[model samples]
Target: MPYITVKMLEGRTEEQKRNLVEKVTDAVSETTGAPKEKVVVFIEEMSKNHYGIAGKRVSDQ
Candidate 1:
C-alpha cells in the first residue's frame, strides 16, 4: 500500500481535490506496483494565515 499526504492552502474546489487524489493514486500505483485501491491519498487544507513567507502571512500577499 502507498500513502500520500498533500498539504495546500484552503479554497480548492471539490473537483480539483478529486482529480488530485485520482492522479496521485494512479501515480503511486504505477510506480510502486500497488493496486489502485491500496493507494491512499490524504489532503490537508490549511488557512492562509497558517503559512507565511518573509514574515508576511500568505493571505496578505
Candidate 2:
C-alpha cells in the first residue's frame, strides 16, 4: 500500500481536491506497483493565517 499526504492552504474546491486525489493515487499506483484501492491519499488544509512564507503569513499575501 502507498500513502500520500498533501498539505496546503485551505480554500480549494471539492472538485479540485477530488481530482488531485485521483491523480495522485493513479500516479502512486503506476510508480509503486500498488493497487489503486490500496493507495491512500490524505489532504490537510490549513488556514492561511497558520501558514507562512518569506517571513509573512500566507493570509497576508
lDDT of 2 by residue, 2-60 (tens): 78999988999999999999999999999989999999999999999999999999899
Q: lDDT score of model 2?
A: 0.94
Q: lDDT for each of the candidates?
A: 0.95, 0.94
Candidate 2: stretches off by over 4 Å: none
Q: Assess every candidate by TM-score.
A: 0.94, 0.95
Runs of candidate 1 with Cα error greater than 4 angstroms are none
- Candidate 1: 10-residue stretch with minimal lDDT: 1-10
What lDDT is obtained when candidate 1 is compared to the true structure? 0.95
- Which candidate's TM-score is highest? 2
